[model samples]
Every structure is written in structure tokens, then in C-alpha cells.
Target: MDLNLRKAILSNIESNDQKQLEATIVEAIQNGEEKMLPGLGVLFELIWKQSDEQDKQEMINALEQGVKQETTG
Candidate 1:
């Protein structure tokens, strides 16, 4: 079977507005299901692709801080 997970994920959320998108993300994270990881990753990939260099750096810094906190806490 041919499956394009990223395309599928995008299609699912394409019509969502800002508030709806936030709700989807929050619900997915709160659910804490392993299956949601791929969808979140797809969303992150889209964000990364659309981001400017400064935005990318900020995301990296935030991620680094999150990882450090996770490891040290």
C-alpha cells in the first residue's frame, strides 16, 4: 500500500483556523498517545520548512532548553 503520512496529516488539518489548530495540538499532547507523535512531527516539519532562520534558531534554542530541563529535572 502507498501511504503518504505527511500529506494525510496536512490534509486533515488544512482547514483548521488558528484556534482549531491550537486545540488539535493541545488535545493530541494531552491524550499522550504514541500514534499522535507522527502527526505532531509532520506539523513540526511544516513549521520548520516555513520558518525563517531566526525562527529556526529560536525553535532550536527552545528545544535545547526543553531537553536540558527534561534531563536535569
Candidate 2:
């Protein structure tokens, strides 16, 4: 699970030696795995930590609108 990966990532970052993480990410992307989607999902889930309320609301509204439009149209 991500518990190990999160720990490793934290260790790598704290150690300032993220080459393994970078290489692993690049290799996964090159292999055409579904890693990109989950990466984005993790990013999206954590976005509120760095986003303002208004920006967060707008992003959620836009995503909901897009989903609704996709489903209806």
C-alpha cells in the first residue's frame, strides 16, 4: 500500500535523494501503466491544502459541471 511508498517518498525527500522515486515514476509512465490517473487523483485529493476556498469551490464546480455534461450529452 501507499503507507510504505509514502514513507519511502518522505525518506527520499528528506534525504534529498529522490532519484529512485523519479526513475520509478518515469519507468511506470513509459510502460503505459494507469499510474498517471492515480497520481493525479492523489494530487487532486490534496489540492485543498494548497488552494484557497474560492479556487477550491470553483474547481469543484467545474469538475461537477463537466461530469454532468458528460453524463447528459
Candidate 3:
């Protein structure tokens, strides 16, 4: 990750009051959000780190094949 982005995240975390974070967490949990506010950023980071162009292409190809097979069947 870029140093600036890391710093910005740290800064945002540091800047937010704890009560607000707790409220946000409560809302996310209560609403059954697939992605909690806190985890969304980390989830994005993980996906970005793990997927390359080639991996994306392979995934698209697999999906295309599955669709074709379904249609033919």
C-alpha cells in the first residue's frame, strides 16, 4: 500500500471519536450488512492485493464457459 494512503487511514481512525465508531458498528450489525463499515476497507485491500489482471481474465473465462455450458444443456 502507498504510504500516503496508509497514513490517511490512520489519520481517519485517529480522528473519529470512539462513540461514532461504536454507533456505526451497531448499525452495521443490526442491519445485517454483508460488509461492516470497518471491514469494507480491509476487504477492498485484500481483493486488490490478491487479484491481478490475469486472475480476473481467468475468472471471466470460467464464468463464460459455465454460462455457455448451461445454455447448451
TM-score of each: 0.92, 0.50, 0.33
Per-residue lDDT of model 2, residues 1-73, tens digit only: 4366544434544543357556655665688777465553444554667899999999999999999998999
Name the best candidate (by TM-score).
Answer: 1
lDDT of 3 by residue, 1-73 (tens): 4467555555655556779766655676698776465454653464567999998788679879999998999
- Once superposed on the true structure, which residue ranges of model 3 sit more than 4 Å away at CA? 1-49
Q: Please, what is the whole-model Cα lDDT of each candidate in the order they appear?
A: 0.95, 0.64, 0.66
Candidate 3: the clashing residue pairs are none
- Tens-place lDDT per residue, model 1, 1-73, is 9999988999999999999999989989999999999999998998999999999999999999999998999
Candidate RMSDs in Å, in order, are 0.9, 5.9, 10.5
Q: How high a TM-score does candidate 2 get?
A: 0.50
How does model 3 fare in lDDT? 0.66
Candidate closest to the true structure, highest lDDT:
1
lDDT for position 37 in model 3: 53
Winner on lDDT between 1 and 3 is 1
Residue 43: error of model 2 in Å? 1.8
